[model samples]
Target: MKASKSIVRRTRWPDSAGAPLVTPLQPSVVYASSSPDALDAQYDGTAPGYTYAREGHPNADVLARKIDALEGAEAGLVTGSGMAAVTAVLYGLPGQGDHVLAGNQLYGRSMRMLREELPRMGIATDMADPTDAAAMAAALRPETRLILLEVVSNPTLRVSDIAGIAALARERGILLAVDNTFTTPRGLRPFDHDADIVIHSVTKLLAGHSDATLGYVAARDPEHRKRLYETAVTLGLTPSPFDCWLAERGLQSFELRYDRAEANARALADALADTPGVRRVLYPTRPDHPDHDRAVSLLGDRGGPMVCFEIDGGRAAANALVEAAPDIAFAPTLGDIGTTLSHPASSSHRGLAPETRAALGMTEGVFRVSLGIEDADLLISEFRAAIAAATAG
Candidate 1:
């Protein structure tokens, strides 16, 4: 039966002491069974009994189930971190001579994983512009089996043609894996567009408190799910039971938090579009955005809580503003509950060469604003004063 999106998020595993108002954390590493048939089911992966923490845990299982329903996936696997999730998929799927086509606009670690780490394992990766369907199509080769892209990329806020890319991938018998961290399942869902896998850094958004460093990869095929699960076990990159429980607890308020953040982001995008030291605003809701049309069709009205822009004087100006900003603090990551800002040049995209970063629109002047549940007018007024003061300094 199809799960209702409204109620599925609120669903949780019933507790031993009967139903509680909220789900409690389960940290047991292993389970013991008295029935021999139940033991057999655990050995064959049929039953729900968790034998070891490395394989699975109750909290992690609950988190995975929620992610599966949220992502509209057949199954979901939770991992220690976002990079772990990415590694599990890349490590499991490709081998010697297999090629992966990835977008150049990925997060620095993800780019490093594909360009540096994956090659170490004998797999080849090609970087391409995910926004360009024709370019991605031309880059596909016989050995190209997986395509990697991020929905609403970080820092520069680039949006891709998911359904178009997925269609092209499907036509070529290739798999398309989308990193849904920036937009989350609330803002956009790749599965609805026929994407093979949806990857997320649950640490950033789903956890909300910036406490849990975890990730999840959702796949609609059972066979692909088996491979991911096996890879996760072998890699020893399983998410902790406490983090999983926290993530599950955080999932309950996702709708409320996401909606408020998106609204705040929309306001900030408009206010920062023509700020004294700002060159341009890159939010999906803005009509002037290059990918605005695509975002509307694929992501609907809410385009996540990220509003990125370029400053007037490049790196120096960005540093001045970021350093002197009073109302905002310098945070390296996004999707947290507090209003925070990050400069990609020194943080997320610092690993990329200057030329490469420029090519991907992630310049030194580029900074991203992750709107929280704070009052929009208050944030706007304070940020405007901060920008003015920074420019003066």
Candidate 2:
């Protein structure tokens, strides 16, 4: 062969008899086929082979299967980002003239998509409190096709009534899609509560380290799953093989990390509630939390790794606390291995109108903490000092 051809066409290696303990990453955007018939088989889904990474790939498939197994889903699809997964569902499941009912307290971007983006596509959406059955019922229309909600609301940490909402959706012949980003499968499985579809921002707890940005969609029904996959492919929402590989690695220790973080969260919640500057603490494990009973029934004894508290002096106090505590990173994101803080008024829900935020009880005083696998006592001490510093002036 010529120099160029030789460099491009390397000899194929023989397969090893032993299997790798970890799934190897396959980054090939294109695959070779022995014949045109074989290539056609791949394209038509008659054979088990990859034709293009945009449609499907080995690493993405492996991670999807792992997520499927974890969530008890019949089928799964991995996407480039959490918003991609949401977009896929919105576009894939419902059509023009079909309406969607969403929880009032979903992630800010999701709300924006349903309220603003979907309308441009001729799809309609209405927001209702997922915890209030009457509100949900009133919000539903004859054209309602799907219901979307988070298992736990962002920043505020409101535990949703999955079983109730699922039952209502079933009665109305509407599909129920639950974003299980916060609770994760270890804490709560939406399928067990009769959710038709489950979504995850694998960038969070599932990935655990905040290194990879990935999202997943899984369905109990095979047809919905297939539709989501097709939509993802059509939209070019495929994830990188490298990010999928990283997510799989993080998932390996997800349970251990989750347990440690949950423990720390429980401890910190109690300590913060008693602190001087804290007006309220919102954690499902705490009896004072509005959804405490629902959380215990749905998520068991653990309240999850996230905790929210309202500082006495609104944004000023929150800013002071963040500045005083150099130990806790002031990251707008969540689910890192180390403790971090997010200000909802500034980061997640900044786009919403002031009245809308007030309705959700997301006052400027509120600050969200993503508890890490740190010593509970140390976290408590740091938070107490931060609260004192913030309140002192």
Candidate 3:
């Protein structure tokens, strides 16, 4: 009652009882309780409240629950970025001397984490061809505790046999973690195939736009979820409330965006296959793709929201095409509402040795195109013209 005028105005809190049609942003770092007992209950996880944003928050809980529903997961946690999601699972599950078996085909950052970072902590990792069940089995060690995979590997568009790999992991008591970033739940729910853990870069298809930088980790078991949460909090990987709110808005039109992008992807792949100077077009359903049969069996008719192609003249031709396509942004990211192009050699896989990149089929000529909801015909024309421009004398 005796406080200054500024303090009185700043301390005023909204007391409205009406509900909003959308999820509201709760950015408060700390929360208050009616009593010490109530605060203690919240801290002990017995009460339904968040005492700290870094530990947990309303926005993250809402988004995580939505992801759980989408992925058919029992529980989920949201983190700051896609790599953070991977980090939470890796650090949360395995301890020193434990081995991790990862698919040879993976995002560059993920590969780096396994090959470079995990080893620093005394955890060992081995790369195996996930498409070949025999190779994966052979790579497994008695100390192997986790098998990391991507439903559809980034850039290259290789589709893994989720059911087969899940079976292998289950038989061996290994926890299988699949990144569904490339093929969101709309395209494939890894959990349906018995995958123990599901991960997502919510910045991609789930959000349907490039506005949010968030990641998600989901699991069927309560203990796994608890461990992930604890690891994420301990590492300060908590997501921003604003980003979580943004992602929730994006989720409202996720399926719509995904369907349109996938259509564009298929159309673009078909068009590019017939164009000159295009050495090869890599799409999951395409007969030319290495994993064509597996893709068809696993994804049904969905080819996902990406298409890749090889230029005839390596980096020069790739650069020419990028420069010619003024309409399509040449960005180093994916899963946006508008089409974008990324050259892996100079971006994603740039850190790897040249020989290693070649072994993985990520040559200088490869162009990873993320399709959008734009007019398919328009994109086809633009790409053809751009390719012609790149190849022109």
Candidate 4:
């Protein structure tokens, strides 16, 4: 009548003749272990269940387990913020005198860390165009220990050839770390394309809301996973339990939210392509985009929710348009459900040098839009009105 721990049962009673029942069950706890001497052991270096909240917590573990399932990773680690995730991955692998090769259009803070801070720490780095497979290959050197790239570049919306870069890293015995914040695991899985490590700004698409700030690092190999976990623990980069709980709740409907947001993005991109005062529309699905084919192959039918466009006017005009928008909020952040716009020149990418910004093709007129679940027609009309106002001004 009662069963547990993965068993099958069949029962029949004389009183209920000719009636049969079958049931399958599993144990409540898959595995459990605890050490009696742990009280005396200050730090036994044992995985005898979480000993401290800073090192690990139940909520974080649960979220990590969920991420591991979705990302198909051996293990996952949670961090306080996305930059903390980046820092953990970089510090986990490289030490003094090591080299790192990073994509050109990386998140601005990431670029600052690699180009400015890493050098002071005796770590060398070189930037390369992620879309250029040959350039990525050529950037590797004997001292190169890591290759950092984004699944989908920020601001520009340029999708990289992750498979090609991963293969090159494998050939050189270098670790490939991909920032998959732009394209979450549901939209695209970087590990499936040969990435050794995948990182996400859980504050972004993973949370699907702007309330919680969390980051995650998912490793393809167990060893790498352990190294990341150890680094996070040592650095005290663990996220708070409450934030982890919120992020876990947000992740439940991530796939559904992404679908609606991405669909709205596609419709907005199509509408903006032919609109007046628009110099160019940049979305991964656009035919003219350099990596459109690769994006189609990697992301398939869905391109993603973020879109970047260049207006006919320069920085002033772009700023004017953002100010004139009635519906979309002008903010520095992205990957939110409500429509938000940003001027990368002065916000996200402002930390970079002017020459470096120009080199990455981040022009002054560029404006990025993170589409939400609002009506596509309304978004288009808001943009049309904003553009007209900016041009008239």
User: For candidate 2, what is the TM-score?
Assistant: 0.97
The digit string of per-residue lDDT tens for model 4 on 1-393 reads 775655354333238455434211211222223455663353575434555677776778778888888888766898999999999998888889999999999888998899888898899999998998899888888999999999889989888878788889988899999998998887888878888888998988888788888999987777888888899989889787778888888888888888888998998898888888888899898787778999898888779999888886777898789788956889887778788898888999998777877777788878899988788889989998898888775
Better of 2 and 4 by TM-score: 2
Name the weakest run of 10 consecutive residues (lDDT summed) in model 1.
7-16
- Clashing pairs for model 2 are none
Rate residue 307 of model 4 by lDDT: 88
Poorest 10 consecutive residues by lDDT, candidate 4: 22-31
- lDDT of the structure predicted as candidate 3: 0.90
Task: Write down the lDDT that model 1 would get.
Answer: 0.85
Backbone steric clashes in candidate 2, count? 0
Question: How many clashes would you count in candidate 3?
Answer: 0
lDDT tens readout by residue for model 2, 1-393: 545655567567669999899889888898889999999987888999888899988899888899988898866999999999999999999999999999999899999999899999999999999878778889999999999999889979988888888889999999999999988888888998998889999998888898999999998888888899999999999899999999999999889999999999999999888888788999987899998898888887978999999877877888898899998999888899899998889999999998899899999888899988988899999989998999887
Alpha carbon lDDT of residue 203, candidate 4? 89
Residue pairs clashing in model 3 are: none
